[model samples]
Target: MTAPITMFGPDFPFAYDDFLSHRAGLGAVPAAAHGTEIAIIGAGIAGIVAGHELMKLGLKPVLFESDRIGGRLRSEPFKDGAGAYAELGAMRFPPSSRALFHYFDKVGIETIGFPNPLAPDTPSTVIELGGVKHYARTKDDLPKRFAEVERAWAEALEEGAHYGELTAAIRARDVATIKRLWHHLVESLDEESFSGFIANSKAFRELGFRAREMFGQVGFGTGGWDTDFPNSILEILRVVATGADDEHRLVVGGVEQLPRRLWALVPEVMAHWPSGTSLASLHNHVPKPGVAKIAPGTTKKFAITDRYGTTTEYDAVIVTCQVWLLSARIDCSESLFHHDLWMAMERTHYMQSSKTFVMVDRPFWRDVDPATGEHALSMTLSDRLTRGTYLLDNGEDKPGVICLSYTWSDDALKWLALPLDDRVRLMLHSLRQIYPTLDIAQHIIGAPITVSWESDPNFMGAFKANLPGHYRYQRRLFSHFVQDDLPEPHRGIFLAGDDISWTAGWAEGAVTTALNAVAGIIRHLGGTAHPENPDPIDRWSDLAPVRLVE
Candidate 1:
């Protein structure tokens, strides 16, 4: 028998019965005539943004989602009297995502800088390496971090040059250099594990210890290993550096409020508004029109199911699910989109991460850092005992609530594979690293709640990673709808999500991709659309390498 669903805290905010009833109500809406302007699959931030943009252009968009509207941006209420909510999936936005910030502003959402609890001016971060605690104040204080990172970049540059030299011999366009370097990066990453890649490099070893320090200081997770390009570490570094200045923040009420506000902006044009819909399978063809077969016995008029157990039909479908899930449902024969792209996407790996909100009768950490008082956000690289724990202060209610987020790499996943009690013990043990004095047994009022994105069938991972050999394919996939082989209004389906652009794995990326997609769609609709300038990092030149004689 399947494992029973464990309820550690109060029930989900929305009543299960209410959610089901809402789903059922959707089926009652009469089906409109075939061939709408657009059909958006996945009502996550990407789909929501796209739908809103389409409405502004006077076009109607039918939004579809298999589960919740927020996608990974989900938050749930804490059971204890914290009077606060904890993020089950994604949290925080990078400051660089100006487009996303504008969207939130337009919707009247406000964000506050994360309040640091440990040290207001400069937070104290520690990394637990092989069960030992190493502390650092500023990012630069981390030993050997810069040297190791520089060495890795040097190696990557050398590899790129070698590859570029060969490609340039055949053709001289900047495209050749970009493609060659891109190919080299992806191949190198795919050939070995990220750890293995560093170990094998003599230059990397010289810098590896320092590299770890740098990553630890900056709170870089193993998730960093998954990228769209393997060969260009420099590119990834640039994106990371650019995003570092951005502070993590939340909308006054909740991040979900952002999507709800967007929907309110254009309710009439959105499909299944204030409701829900499910997509069965999508049909993609070049010359002829594509169809999305809906399932029968659907809960609402928007509900769809078909004979092969598929349902829902649309003139155009924009899929925003993880690349892997999209690959499974795609009809390869009819899709002009390359199959190699799908294969490369499957090879990318995602780390299993978990976030838990502990509701204590008091803001325990506040006492630990008395100077800052109770309302401060402190981000830590390591807990005395736990790996990957970051502390966030939820500025709501006294005996304030702090959300402790624990992220695990492959090693932690192995520990998670253990029995439930063992996992709980492990979590508590890790908590001791941060608070050695507090008796977790006594202070804990109730069972802790955990959300594992990796374990979710629908998600399977937190977000898309740009692993080695994957960049080219990722770029192509992001631009698929805009390619010439597709029908008029060729950019009919724009891919939006964290994985689509440089801001991949971020909310900003989702918004940026949505903006780009919307612009394309508007242009196709005969509306004037102007392209924005390339990202600042896109203008950077490859750093010249230093040569050493052995």
Candidate 2:
């Protein structure tokens, strides 16, 4: 049997899963540094994971949040009290996220197959484009033109990126082969956009214009690559190469539970802290107020000021929030980071995302329509304004939720100015075009919930999507965790979160990067990782992302 492909990095192939599962634990700090306080800015999965690990290493992790915790793993609950909720932020997670699953297992969170378009368990799928609607249970049910686009995509990957060999190497954890193949691709394709890659590929060229449009509208794995067309081809390839876009599962209640649970979990085995101690107990079950300012203090410490005008100094700081907030919302000192690092943070392009969800009486979509002998509604992928619609079935007896519209980038921007009622009406209008007989509004139980990440002051955008020629910028950010090559003034602060990872927008990236921050902190405060369970920094020399010449 072929080894399962995981998010083991075509960029940095360190095994974070192994490190987390190891019995030796993530090393310890010196006796003097044991009780050192480390400020973690942001209460998202990244911040929480970093704090949890840091706490285990006999360090005090102070978490600061501007808004609600869990960041993008937002699970907004309905008043019905039946455990139904709208996943306003991250909804699906791929199984390749081994490191993230470690926390899920630790927290006792369960997962079920996500209702992605064309997924096996998804009752059915509706692919509508250019005023044409095609209902399909699988790819074979779609017209031959879609098959051509699918074939074109496969051929394009194999031809342009050596997809087969690279994926094989990734599955086997053959770091040498992965680095060799990926480095060459990055050097050659870093400047190419996803659309440019498809347009220039021989397979796509043969298929012509409409085929390319189809591929963009209803992409492989998840759905729709049109919004991502402007991003670097390397970004798309990383998703495909590492199986980051395949076999996705939804967390059983909501993904937010992962971070929340981690915050409250008390490890049975810990270093300095007692067995019963937890992050919540340490902070009195509440995080500090939002950060107002961050500046360098005496003796290489960081001075953090909260919104309530309280100031405190810490030995080190881990910033897990969106890097854009550094300039947008916070008063940060210029001397804290190098100019090149600032340039990288500024250049990091974030994609806007909007999701509008409504709770229905039950899984009404499963009802059969007499006239057509088909289900009333299905998981939808479309070119219309309501780009993708998903049906979240809780159970036959419980209320079901429908993500009326889930859009990214331009589509999300279109909904940014619209009010909740207007947004719902517009999305329902678009869905009406697809399902004329389905009375969706009649089944809606409660008020709809919606969010546009770009509109929120706390999160400027949903997640990072590297633009063409952004490899250098991303390299600078991802490598900041290993600060050996950095200047004295910039040495202590570490940048983490999915945005700082090569594979952004995935929870695995968030968890792995948080682990990176943990390792960085351990080393910075006079600690070392166990030789048997070497952390990311320990293996940085051999597996660091390839840096391109300017």
Candidate 3:
């Protein structure tokens, strides 16, 4: 009934709204299969969503979660309790994420413009690089030199990548035009790193190293993308062209609310259960054990063994966990997937992220400075160990949250071995250097919370960020959700996650990919996509990812 929810991002102009808007039915779950159980692995957003939707189509979905339900969209409340919390993962979300926004709107989770480092909503930003402190509320407030660097970067996109042409084609959903524009980019930029793109681009070449270095220190849109400098240019271009790195917002409670709510959201239809069927009702109130192994069955249909060595069989299985788990954690049979697909899963590199949060008595940073008379310091970017510092304002009455340090890559690795106290001390020392006169320590009301996703056994890294020359690898993984091409044994098992999405690191990608997996599972089980809202394969040639070679 409503307009289709599509991401106009040139990388993959997937119409998620089309899939959701299917009014009649998702396809044929044979009369015999109606009540048959489908095994859904990893109770993260992708798995929860796929399970939720499949249940509506008269299939019984048994969701198995190894850890928490939310996955990388982690929102940890203060030790005192819930509400004022630190987002160890996925804090800010972009407005352009229509698929993700759809569910948020469905559940009535309110969102407010996030005050990201240099974005328009942030009251002020302090760029501390090379010991010099520069302050601004916007790009206009930034120094002329830095402004020119930003301009040069924008200009380079227009000329070098045909940014305007590609963006327009993507927004128009002109698949032919998108393929024409993107294929060239895939060929030209796949092997080239982000740093390489800057060096080769006409504008950056003209501007020289200083401009490139400046761009690295305080990046365009999101904070320093320098850690991503070695990744493919196509990756950055997609984020920039889609406007995903701009016009951001954060959930009032936490971004994780979207998935967590979906976990408990009652399905409209129930196959074997009563009227109001939720994920919890499908399983007993007790939590399920972690998955230890998955393999094609001799007669059990599909075999799944839990950590406790309990095994179960299902007609189909959907794996929504990080790909690395298949290799390092799960004892899956080599025969389960093609070698190339397995290689892609193993090669899917996930970037490390570190976040430290402390509760302050109030929004103390909003106060005036004694010496210079500026709001003490709102958001900070620095060359120090604390690469980016964000201030979260809960309320004037309630305690505010200070994300003392948020760093990625090697910068994150620095705090890995340190205890919470030592990490907090290092962050405080780094902050004191930027705000020399402020006694920021005095306002602290609670112990700091910290996380290194890289150190976590369950999650190898925060989210996926494809490397240069890895487009081929991603294309294989992205296409795996489409079951028609798979061998018979692989047909019943589906792969779905943000990692398997083109626009990795965003919730919309996870939702879109999850929905694709849902469609795949339907077709695999002899169901058809609704006529009005066809499956992705129905529009594959035009919308499929650009193959670099062969």
Q: Which numbered prediction scores highest in lDDT against the true structure?
A: 2
Please give the TM-score that candidate 2 achieves against the real structure: 0.99
Candidate 3's TM-score reads: 0.96
- Candidate 1's TM-score reads 0.66
- Score every model by TM-score: 0.66, 0.99, 0.96
lDDT values for all models: 0.48, 0.92, 0.82
- The stretch of ten residues in a row with the least summed lDDT in candidate 3 is 1-10
Which candidate do you rate higher for TM-score, 1 or 2? 2
Alpha-carbon lDDT of model 3: 0.82
Model 1: how far residue 433 lies from native, Å: 4.9
Candidate 2 RMSD computed on C-alpha atoms after optimal superposition onto the true structure: 0.9
Q: Which residue runs of candidate 1 sit more than 4 Å off their true CA positions?
A: 1-37, 80-82, 115-235, 244-246, 266-312, 329-336, 344-348, 368-379, 383-385, 399-405, 415-422, 445-447, 487-491, 523-550
Per-residue lDDT of 50-78 in model 2, one digit per residue for the tens? 99999988888999998888999999998
Which candidate has the highest TM-score of all? Answer: 2
The local lDDT score (0 to 100) that residue 424 gets in candidate 2 is 95
Predicted structure 3: clash tally = 2
Ranking the candidates on TM-score from highest down gives 2, 3, 1
**Clashing residue pairs found in predicted model 3:** 5-17, 28-527
Per residue, candidate 3 scores C-alpha lDDT tens digits across 1-550 of: 4222136646666667656665664555666668778888888788878878887777878877788878888888888833688888887888778778878887788999898977767778899889999888777777898878888888888877998787777667777788788888888888889898888888888889978988887887778878889888888887887778887898898878877787777866555557887766777643467799998776656889999999988778888888899889999888889998998998888989899999998988778766765789769989899999999888788899999999998899999999999999999999999988788899998788999999988888988888898999999998887767677777778889888988888887888888878888787778777677667766676577776664
Off by over 4 Å in 3: 1-6, 269-273
